[model samples]
Target: MRDSEKILDSWDAYSDEHTDLDGWPHDDHAYGLRASQRDADTVGAFEPLRYGARHLLATAETQLAQLPENTVQSRWVYQLGVLHAALDRLDELHEQWLVTRDALPATANPGTADFDDALAEHHAESWSYLDDWATHGKALREINTAAHKAPSALVNAPVRRTAAQK
Candidate 1:
């Protein structure tokens, strides 16, 4: 299955397990009963991204560890480059949110409508970045698949040690 299908499939299972005992009223006469939308967007988005990224990194690390001595260097370079890019996107957004929150007036902390607006703007932009990441990430995933299949041919020659290196 594709990555997003894997995510939502798992989420559906999780949602079922965490289902609330009580739910909105249902009526046979009414055709328009709508389900309540849980305001768990923060938990919903960030957590899976985190978990998936973690899974990918750990898998890449395991693959790197299993590589032949002469080839280990190259696979790690590809994996680490992608891993760091993903992390960099997340880290920048986290820092942006943290800095914005810190600079906010202490009195307007979280629940107020203005606070919600600010957060909405923050999250909206972050989601846009995520959309772009998903697009680029799909392409990178293909590159990774190729890299994994041909580590020796795929890896660039070793980088020269820097002057600062021990």
Candidate 2:
């Protein structure tokens, strides 16, 4: 089966496993699992956008190369280049942080008395990285918006709303 299929299958199993509430109104263990899965799903949803950004950044590089050198247009391209560079570095750092976070063991076992402690520690580290990753992603979006508007707005100030307004 495909990777997506595998992911779906795992999700199905997880959902089934968490459906039980035991004697309580809500099963705390299962609820926590569901919440963590939701977080993972959110990150998974954005993976495609991140992948697309990488390709677009490469395209920007090629397009920037073909522009006239030492001109206003070239300056815009240079600004985009700098933004892309910083965004790329952020991506790299996020990946490294995620790798380190995921490398931590989830828990010892069902027999271990310290499972809650271990799991809490794992979540603390992983969620912190996840939050940073999300913030970095927002920065990338802001930089991209700035890049999109920079060509017409950076060197040319007092942009007119319309020909009549100018």
Candidate 3:
């Protein structure tokens, strides 16, 4: 098997063994998996990030769908919208990266300086999405906490009205 395949297979085994019922691994385990793949295969390493974005998108969609129509002031509704937007942007970037990677000649030399520079650029962009994702996640958690602990505060908070609502 190719090195990328082997790396992904190991990751699958580790994820299967470590993930909770929600399919989220502990932070340390996830960091370890990323560390193992970072130097080996950039494309293969991006699989987890893509999967995570998809998962969050689906979850946010579900949560938004489940909310009642009258929940205009609900913090969760707003937070889920933010989460969805962040995930969507991440997904778009991943697609662009795939197109760029696939457009490279199959016979390109991996050891060339040009190849190394391109790989570095792609890797940097890929990892940058993590910062955006984490920021959105932190915001979501804060919203959840506020919604639970001070429900009245969220209820009274002014929501941005859409043009339709205005």
Model 2 per-residue lDDT at 16: 69
lDDT of 2 by residue, 86-133 (tens): 446647656665565565467644346455444444443344334434
TM-score of each: 0.42, 0.32, 0.41
Give each model's clash number: 0, 0, 0
Better of 2 and 3 by TM-score: 3
The TM-score of predicted model 1 comes to: 0.42
- C-alpha displacement of 103 in model 3, angstroms? 2.9
**Model 3 TM-score (2 dp):** 0.41
Error of 2 at 12 (Å): 23
User: Which residues of candidate 3, in runs, are more than 4 Å off?
Assistant: 1-49, 64-78, 107-111, 126-128, 139-166
lDDT of 3 by residue, 1-166 (tens): 1343455456568777877788776787665546445433634544565566566556555544544445434555565666666567667776776687677777645776656556656655654444344444544444434434544646877999999999
In terms of lDDT, the poorest run of 10 residues in model 3 is: 139-148
lDDT of 1 by residue, 1-166 (tens): 1453444455456555555555322442231111111112432455557647656656665565555665444444564566557566766876787888887777766788667656666665555344334434444454456447765633656767788984
Q: 1 or 3: which has the higher lDDT? A: 3
